[model samples]
Target: MDSGVELKKFGLPSQCCECGPQKSPALCSAIFATSICPNCFGMSVTPGTRYHTLLNTNEPPDESELTFVRSVASTVDASLEYLDHEIANLPENVKRLEEKRASLLSYRVRNNAILSPLRRIPPELLREIFSWTMPSLEGTAEVALCIEQTPWMLTQISRRWRVVTFSTPSLWSQIFIDYRHSHINRDPSTYSPSLMKAQLDCAQKLKIHFYGSQGIDLRPQIDMFKLLSQHSSRWEELSVELTAEMVPILMTLRDRIPSLRRLWIQWSTVEDQTGVHSIDCFQTASSLVDVGIFNDYRFVPVLLPVHQLTRYDMDCQLEEHIRILKQTPNIIEARIDIAFDEEVGSDSLETVDLLGLRRLYISPAGVLKYFKVPALEELALDIYGEDILSLVRSLLDRSSCSL
Candidate 1:
């Protein structure tokens, strides 16, 4: 007997209805008995075989194939039940794997945090790093109080940062605030008077840069000023823009401010340009080194111990500048914004030689003709009028300045 035709002894069909030419067929589920297994096919499951042809078509079989067809169906149904049980477990298996993956990710993050260099740094060094984030109040930008500012923001980052920020005095030393918030109807959240008080309390010595509206005065502003004035002895640097009404309040600082080194004051009024309100509060600032007074119209006047000043800035007439410059013989740097040139003959005027002056700035051309600064190294001139170069050259030649 031929080996390929051996399965025919079981009287099985030779052709499958799946492919008409009876290509290589399979009986993947052929056996159904005590053990339902495909291997019980008794021959290889291939094309042109009895079980392959019947199972592929699943059509009504001839009477001779009826028994074999029912056997294949029972075996397929059992295999489907096994697959149904496995499919039902898929969701739980996926959920368990996902939870395991999340746990590993969390563990990795915590491990990395433990190894971070910042955790191992000294607290003093870490606090110094935080202090570098403090803002430099250069013009009027810091005049408005905002909780979002860097110094205030540092306190909110974490418990460690908040503790470090509170201990660093330089972070709180610069207190800049405009007492004119009520004019704009600003939100209370935009600034905090109590926070300013807390800042003053935090720093040992303070640099107070205060500003306010030109005309309007509020009780809160007065109270804040008074509160700051109480610490006059601790003021290292003071800059303010004041009106006539604030003059008496500043007079309270007389015989009070001793640590004051740098002072700048601006008159905050346009209505009373001719009215000069003088306060001798800063005359007691014996340690005062640098003074800046913008004498636009002299509405608010101040007195400083000018003899000891190294740097002086004033917007004044030529005679007034010479008068003040004579007093400040120690002045090394001076910015004179000439209000108007005096008509005095050059021969009548004594050539004022600023012996130690190294840096000089002046405007409107004629002030240089009066100054003989032998030590002048840098000269900034806002030149006007004809023969300005000749005027500068005359200043350099007679003074023998290196500028």
Candidate 2:
């Protein structure tokens, strides 16, 4: 018979020989049982010479050629059957290697933990080192963002470090709360409550600096103020910028802040001129001394016990500064920015003697002539106006203070 024509009639194997051994055997066996013998199907061998010659000469293949093909098919099928059994065990080998790797990693971690030098440092010294990591107050925004990071990062370093960082009250005492810096987009409630409680728990005395920004939600700011007010007795030094809506929240701390000493308040907006015109929050704060008021002209009238202040800083109209100086005779140092309004005329104003004042920083050099600082030693004036020298000479003459 013609081999080419017979091969076409028998057809090729249904599955590839390269397939994994499990599927290959059944497919190979079925192909071998068919008219195509196993040898031709598995090895894909060329047919005998008679089959090759038949293409050119039209000769038929003898029975011997058919017998040889049958024998080869049987041997090839046996080899495939054995190989399929070996391939099935590969998954188990892979799993064993993975388990070995995991065990090694676990051992390495345990060994490294035992040898870590950081664990050897004493708790006291470690706390001191953590204290040094605190950011300085040069940049308010940067300091505010880093506040949450300093104590948090130290605690995460190790269990021992966590204990040390939490125990150190000074690390948490100076808190910088900037609504614009870190929590610009997040709701303040997310981090405020837990952070405030944690700080309060760790610190005995708090120096809180709250920096506000425009367009932020008022609720969070008000909430923070309310929370802080609850612990007003622990407030040692507080510097906060308030919007019109948040002004009332601050006023709630009136007569309650007995421990307040240094106070700094700034108004973010001027729309509600009458709202904070009289801030009596620290009216009963006997410990209050150093005071800095920015952008709020009405702040001076409401501050109680101004006579006890040792340092004062304010940006207000000329007459208001004079009014404040008249009340604060005990002030040792004063920084005043004079805004010349129509009400502040060159008409002779009363001479207020600051008998105890040592340092005076006043804007508009001419305004110095109006003050009588008898003990003033250090003077920094924003030198302007035509008769600055005459003003200085006149002030020195009136006070008899050596410049």
Candidate 3:
């Protein structure tokens, strides 16, 4: 036979069982064996296996492919076993380590807490820290919890922080319970007393603010004042803004709080013109060295009995205050509120009759005409709605003639 005809007669066709005469077969398998055609066998196992076990023909494995496959299989097996062991032990190990870290932190905090450092510092230095932490006047808003909000920064650092916060009386002092801007409206009855007592115990100065709450009847003020009266000796300063009707309850506190030094009793800015009659609360602040009374022209004369006051401010009929200046002997500083006129007159000069007065502030329309001012040191005059040059000229003339 011819050479080509004899080769075709002996050769096997390239088709496989997996290919099934449709597509190229990378592999074909049975229970006993897996076979790949020479064209596709590279896709299945390596050439090394082909020579050793797969093929009855004479082709052999490429040595490089055999070495790569053996190394890959060993690595894959080792990785799987190692991953299993790591997954099995991870959670328990994490829990144990977390517990140990928590214990260590707790020990560190307790050992290094604020109390020890606080105790070691001198009392004067401690007082300065107390002063530094004290809250400034927060206008009409509710007092924000500056230290309480920053508990983590100071308190969580060590055991000493907690001790210092609790032990330092000055730190806890000056609790401002401003019911005006608080959520106190939701349950006023239940909440007011508790806050009052807590603040009273912790603070030496108390500021009870009542902002924009018409619903807060006088009963709450009375109750809180009663509670504060119980701790009167510690109450050093008080700033109260209440309805004109709450004056009675506040006056009850005057005798009880022997330690009270400063008292500010004023009406609401919004509720300025509500009541026809004015009530006086200043007479009760006997220990008061500073007082501010806000009233209409018709209401200021009744409070002149508080003559022992060091500082006094009144928004009332300025002419009516002449009687007050005539009576109160030790008036150090006085601010009298009244409309002024340009004309220099005897009545206007008589208004500042506090002979021992050191500081005097008069309003825009007030005319200081004639007076015997012996100890008058600082005088402030507000001259509005008038000819500025003429007013100054008349003042200079009067000042020269008086001298």
Candidate 4:
């Protein structure tokens, strides 16, 4: 609107005029430094300000000038329409995504400001948070513990985040009882039973692995067993990897735990026990439903006494093993690892009479011997020579056995 700045003409087409129609000769200079219609100065142009500089310099109307207003109007209308559709169709999705983003940012801020200063937090809260995010039955206990110890970024940023982290019970639930996955040596005495007891006090399932250097202490093993016995009422699953010294404790647990539905035991060393002393420990646990056992010796068949057991797994290769396993009346599935015996005459042993067995695994040796087993969905063998393969073929010839 300054007087010194003469409004020049931007000689555009009549259709591009600011006003509907013009009467005077178009000077074709911009009124200001805008793409303005020259006939009626800038007043007759569209609502947007236009430059006069281009027309004064003999330049044609820019493509930007031609379409800017219309395109802007179209974009605005389209945006409003899109907003309306999105509000109706995907409101929750948009809201959740935005909230997640906000949560991430808030956590970052908190980590930078608060939790870094106060290193330790209440055990309960730490355990709870860990329970929410820690890998469930997937990761090793060490890795899960390390992840739980990872500092909350938001807590590092401010006091409020630290307070929230400290107060939340979910944070503490992350502390789980890891008996099987955590590294355990011969000295069960060295284990922190109190800490484990506190964390897994309410746990429904527990997996414990036990190994030894030369031998294990009987007393500590008994103490550990006592701890398990105390909490056995709530236990739903139990997996125990045992050494020879832990037999007494293992045997005692059958009577103590009434709620156990699943049990897995792998006995590495039996301390050269014959059937005389071993049979005393065999007690039929009625509640036992699923059982997997890895026995080193063929003479001991402790788990076979559980007649009510429905599922059984034995990773052993004894020829007469199935005879013991046949004691389980209701067993619908049995996975037995059997070793081959070449010296034993193929005709001496009777055919397997597992009337209820739907699954069986026989070593290549067992396949070689003239054998009749019940209909099995799966069978595997360790083949040493062509004789074994021939035996397998001969056995499968009776039925089409696919690997």
Candidate 5:
């Protein structure tokens, strides 16, 4: 190796035998520059990085340096032994550090519980937040018949939350129960009356949705319907689709549902065939405003306080819908799928003016001429591509409304 390169690598003086270890690099350089032999520059009294350079500077080491070579070899062996001993303790050291880290993490979680943001929220405010998460029973949206969810789940949080949910009457007032929740062999207790009884007892003004099919031995559902019907005075809305003498049972509560406002009724019969039942069970409901009757296959004429209705969604013939719209001039939204043996010609169909109607969803767009919706804002028509432009233009122009 070159002397200058060796000097930078070790940060040490390129010493001679005469110039000792205590001498500075500058002193050594000056001593070497003035020395008689420039070849003896790298020889040092003690071992350093320059010592290796000294050994490789010329030929092999002389016999006089054998003892010094053995001393350096022994020093390297002792250093290796010390490092290996330290490496053996590494696993124990890592285990202790990991234990400390885990303990500190758990301590932080425990301490955070006292000042958690959930703890800061009041019980009434939490109840309000929960109401938005739960489904609204008044609408047509289907809700699952699970007791281990929502308001029930909220009560399981803690004692304070349980008391809060139990005290909130609105949380328990709305329920949607289906007959399929019960299985004779698998889980018969799924739709037990005891659960409904507890739910009804906690509820105030109720919005109940009861759905049951035909020929399923809907004994549990019937029992539940009987339980819910007892609280008919508290009813604010009823979406009924059940069988097994549900009609006569509901008939007893004709005038009793005074607080009822909205109704969705669908009659069920043998083998899923739409049964004909003249349902006026909810007719005397004084506060009723919204109504929907499923009449796609068979139209069961529902006698409602039609003049006060704000919304009507019925699947009936054109003539029948026109007859209903005549009674419901105040209807704001209408979704009518007209069933027919023959389409009614625009000239012969009666034009009913619904000045208050804002949204109209009609199937087969050909029936647009029957209603003159002057205040129409949203029109949903089901038709093919070619007939769209003409039908829509005619409806908009004839209605004389900005849609």
Candidate 6:
């Protein structure tokens, strides 16, 4: 037998029993079990001499081929009917599965809501956790970002959280106002009066920091100062860095800051040679016990309540440093950074006796020989000049105090 003829016999029929014969001739149903005609199946011969002899002839088989094809047609029809019935029920089966999946998901969500751990935390403890989110009111930029981050974020979480955050006064007590760089370009009217009032209303004691950049107009700063000055009695600490033009506005608060305990001020770099402009307003601040002055050469001398001050930090010339110390006889701690422009004539200067001084930090150790701190227990000298060791030894011997 030809190999091509054997290979052709293995090919699938162009037509099957379910659809009857197609335009192409029907395949012999004897070799294939699936979709075979009954007549073709009866005509199929066993793999022997009979099958080989049938392949050799070109003529078709007689009644046996017709009977086999008819029989196969009946069997295929019955099988297709069973498959159609199963396929017809698939939509109902799919609908039931989708419903079960939805039910399971809903039940899981309900169970999770009932078991949520956050609902178990007490209100007081929750408020304390929110409080910790507030940034420390030290640096200028950090404090500005904190206003929008902590209190605002907490209020947005829930109604109860908003009430708790607003009731907590300490969160709003520290206020930092910086008008440096781009911040100075904003319109003064845009500053929120309501927000400022809310902070003032809630806080018992306020710590205010107001900083200004060079070349910025003092008009906006003066307006801000006016608003803050209204509540000066509540200010516990005030730090202001302003231009020389803004000093007069600050001096307006001298007698008004009755509750102020600490004050820090820095003037613009422009030198004040007349020595006539002084911050005499703070002279009446009875509660003012600590004072810090920076860039003193740029401003007229600042007049502080020196006799009542327990701590003083002065960045000034040696003459001004001596002048402030001589007035502050009750100072217990002092940090002095002397400017190098002027030399101190020790022979012409009188010795300042700081009887209550316990801690002293001084740069250009040559200044130590000018002070008589008998009660000094802690001393830090910035060893910048020659004879620092000798100066310290002389200070130790003159005070007659143990190191």
Candidate 2 per-residue lDDT over residues 273-330, each given as its tens digit:
4544577778789899999888654443556578889999887788777777898868
Question: Residue 59 deviation, candidate 6, in Å?
Answer: 28
lDDT of each: 0.72, 0.72, 0.53, 0.51, 0.73, 0.71
> Pick by TM-score: which candidate is best?
1
Better of 1 and 6 by TM-score: 1
lDDT computed for candidate 1: 0.72
Write candidate 1's Cα lDDT for 201-254 as tens digits. Answer: 778888988775554545556667788898989999988877556566888888
| lDDT tens digits by residue: candidate 5, 148-256 | 7678888888888888888988988877876543343355456667767888888888988888766466666677788888999999888888463687687788788
Off by over 4 Å in 4: 1-190, 205-221, 268-276, 279-282, 315-319, 329-332, 339-346, 367-374, 386-389, 397-403
lDDT of 3 by residue, 1-403 (tens): 4422321232423344345676422233231122223333324333443332424555555675465335334544554566688899999989999999999999998788655665587656654664565546655343543334322134454465555554555555564544455466564554346644554565545444333245555567556655655675666676666555555555555456666677665555436435535444445656777767665423523352457877777765545556566667788887776533233345334534455667767665334543335566776778767665665455545444331
Per-prediction TM-score, please?
0.75, 0.66, 0.58, 0.50, 0.69, 0.68
- Say which prediction, candidate 2 or candidate 5, comes out ahead on TM-score: 5
Candidate 4 lDDT, 260-341, residue by residue in tens: 6677765545453433245333255547778776665544555434577778776544455545555666776766655344
The lDDT of model 3 is 0.53
**lDDT of residue 367 for candidate 3:** 48
The C-alpha RMSD of each candidate to the native structure, in angstroms, is 8.0, 10.8, 12.9, 14.9, 10.2, 10.9
Please list the residue runs of candidate 6 whose C-alpha ends up more than 4 Å from where it truly belongs after superposition: 1-131, 137-139, 145-147, 183-191, 271-276
Error of 2 at 204 (Å): 1.0
Candidate 1 versus the native: TM-score? 0.75
Give the per-residue Cα lDDT of candidate 6 at 142: 49
User: How do these models rank on lDDT, best leading?
Assistant: 5, 2, 1, 6, 3, 4
